[model samples]
Target: GIQVEQSPPDLILQEGANSTLRCNFSDSVNNLQWFHQNPWGQLINLFYIPSGTKQNGRLSATTVATERYSLLYISSSQTTDSGVYFCAVGGATGTYKYIFGTGTRLKVLA
Candidate 1:
């Protein structure tokens, strides 16, 4: 079985600030995804980066398998970005299912 851990269980950022969220995995993974759960309880997919770097507007992510960790970067944060960020991983050796971490709750003050 694989294990996932997320850092900074809670985060508070002012609008226009920047922040980085981290996720660590216990084993190698073949699939990974970043999601944002809004206050309304909707899970929105942010990225599906398995082993590289990717950026979407004000958001970006990087995964280093050798270090067994991943990072999510948010630049010029906005009120809309206030939510919970989650990291999910899936590997060949495990149950072949994605396991989601506890998540990093972010609150952006306007």
Candidate 2:
């Protein structure tokens, strides 16, 4: 079985600040995605990096499959970024089920 854990379960940041979120998995995963759950409860897909690194706007993510860990970087944070960030991964050996990290709750103060 594969397990997912997210660090800094809660975070508080001032506008324009930067933050890094982390996710650790117990096993290798072929499918990995980072998502941000907005204040309205909408899950926005931030990245789908099963390996390597990618960036989008003020956000970036890196997944080291060999290390069984992934990281999401948020730069120049904004109040709009206040929400819950999650990492979801699949392809856990013989199972097709996807597992989601506990989530990292972020609050950006303006």
TM-scores, all models, native as reference: 0.97, 0.97
lDDT score, candidate 1 = 0.95
Per-candidate local distance difference test: 0.95, 0.95
In candidate 2, which residue pairs clash? none
| Residue pairs that clash (backbone atoms under 3 angstroms), model 1 | none
Candidate 2 residue lDDT tens string, 26-80:
9989999999999999999999999999999999999999999999999999999
lDDT of 2: 0.95
Report the lDDT tens digits of candidate 1 across residue range 1-110.
Answer: 88999999999999999999999999999899999999999999999988889999999999998889999999999999999999999985756689999999999999
